[model samples]
Target: MPSALGEYFQDDDGSLPEIELRFAQPALLVAALEYLFGLPGAYDASRDTACVWNLIHDREEPYRSPQDARRVASGELAAFHRLLRAAQVDGCVLPDLGVFVSGEELILDYRMGPQWGESEIVALLRLLARLRKRGAQVAVPWWGESGERAFADAIAGIDAGRSAAN
Candidate 1:
């Protein structure tokens, strides 16, 4: 069988899994949420259906709005950095910090968790694909000066890993 065929068969669900995307910038976070919510009709079904949640005191509370995330992103990030810096923290993952976006069928969860399953990884790939297809510039941290090449390399790595498993 072809490698593509073998890889396809390995996936139980050929659908995009629920995803949580972490953004380095508040503007980027807001933009991603806007796209998922179909700000300019990027997703017809999800338009106007996105909600934001802020993680505080180990609990989630509704943010004023998705755009409101930008307002608090700086403060939250600074505090988070301080927390990580204090006490030689290792493996001390923070719960769903900052803003989380959810829509009709899409979830840009943005939670900091300890484990990542294959489903979550695939979901992230699918999410990036969807975003790129919609004309959004999905810039990841490792993109370096050559984003296209880096992204292509990353996808190839996933495919190679899958092929090895088979």
Candidate 2:
């Protein structure tokens, strides 16, 4: 994390449970990041796959065709996740956000402006839910609220923090 990263993961609600993906465990790390790249709007698999390959100790990247090789790999998982967080589609209120994992913490921030609506937060939550559904370690550290309510409540808390700051 750097001083400039301050704008990316700005202090949201303390209740906003910071996402943490266990990279030390390669299997979980690969599964989660690949799952994220395949989400509706985030389509950059080849690049992400390369980064994932670097994480696996006993694996080599499967051979790729010239076209597949054309995809410039992301510098790291954090950069790839940032691209996904910023992706948007028509009729979808995908938050203009950023994702970066540092020192085991996968940080998600809803940009420096624009309070996200409940539905938008839920959309993002659903992607995370997918990871959780797969038995991945998607821990909601203080969010004991359960189901989608936890995420909505977290976003609401973040909005309140933003309001207080202004």
Clashes per candidate (backbone, < 3 Å): 1, 0
Model 1 worst lDDT run, 10 consecutive residues: 80-89
Where is model 1 more than 4 Å wrong at Cα? 1-31, 35-63, 67-114, 142-150, 154-166
- Superposed on all Cα atoms, model 2 deviates from the true structure by an RMSD in Å of 10.5
lDDT tens string, model 2, 1-166? 1221223233454333345443444444445555554555664323445442323243445423222211213222122234354344324547544444443334454443234544444455455555555544554444344523444444344444422111
In candidate 1, what are the lDDT values of residues 1-166, reduced to their tens digit? 2232222223444232223344545566667655443322122222234333334444433334345545456443111100011111122222221223322112332322323333434434444555544434444332234544544554555545432122
Candidate 1: what lDDT? Answer: 0.36
TM-score of 1: 0.31
lDDT for position 58 in model 2: 38
Superposed model 2: Cα runs more than 4 Å off: 1-17, 43-81, 85-93, 101-105, 140-166
Best by lDDT: 2
